[model samples]
Target: MFTTKDATTPHVGLLVDKVEDNVDYKKEDIKPLDKLTEVGFDIDPQTKNMMRGLIKLAEKHSVLIDPSAIFSPVHIAQEDIQESEAYGLF
Candidate 1:
């Protein structure tokens, strides 16, 4: 979920689900998207448009969003890696 330096808006948003009634949520629970990339996540361009639409809808409803919660993590598929190397994009 990493973004280019000039990106004006995020291309994705995280949707965290809660399970435990007594669970405590902290800012630390949400890892920075850039850091996730170092750990093997990749930017999924296919989701960009969907995320933009969701964000726009949320804005229209006056929803307050945490900047840190805007990007979601996704694993980099082996196939994608091979493709990138093949095309010299990695």
Candidate 2:
């Protein structure tokens, strides 16, 4: 997993699936959302500002999550809600 410090909060952390040597992406491939609500995230509008955008990879899709959002308690709580709602059986 990838780990990094949060820009907005000193005590919080930013974690991801994998950390690699930084890769480059085309400008056009990066799609921005006006708000986190576009992705069903129920976070504060302030936290929503941390969302960078989405990156298209072949036929798959990936999100460009901001370190600030990753470190946000509100964002984390919203994610937990989504995850549990999607897979309560686990």
Candidate 3:
């Protein structure tokens, strides 16, 4: 909704339905919405295994990944990208 309309972002040719721009001073000015996104997440036998792989990959680039909320993972991992492991059922 922001990219296609907001002049701050470039035109990415994304398809969006509608946008609301009413600044009515009501109960609240902004309404938060829960959005489900398809994201890549890894789960191993345990947290140790996960940390081992993370450490090994970090050693290659000599950088650590300490993620936090309010930031996108793509922004942090894009510089040192690695091919993801195959998806499977346990």
Angstrom error of the Cα, residue 11, model 1: value is 15
Displacement of residue 45 (Cα, Å) in model 2 is: 2.9
lDDT comparing candidate 3 with the true structure: 0.26
Candidate 1's C-alpha lDDT?
0.35
Query: Which candidate would rank higher by TM-score, 1 or 2?
Result: 2
Best-first order by TM-score = 2, 1, 3
Question: lDDT order of candidates, best first?
Answer: 2, 1, 3
Tens-place lDDT digits, model 3, residues 10-82: 5323233333343233333222211111234333232222121121122231111112211223355346434
lDDT string, candidate 2, 1-90, tens digits? 223455443542334566544657898988776443576855555544555786776875556765544444554545543323533311
**What lDDT does each candidate get?**
0.35, 0.54, 0.26
Error of 3 at 9 (Å): 15
Q: For each predicted model, how many residue pairs clash, with residues at least 3 apart or on different chains?
A: 0, 0, 0
Relative to the true structure, candidate 3 reaches a TM of 0.17
lDDT measured at residue 26 in model 1 versus the true structure, 0 to 100: 44
Residue 52 CA error for candidate 2 (Å)? 2.1
**What does each candidate score in C-alpha RMSD?**
15.6, 14.2, 19.8
Residues 1-90 of candidate 1: C-alpha lDDT, one tens digit per residue: 334324676544445442233433444344444443475756565433223211112223111232322332234332343323333322
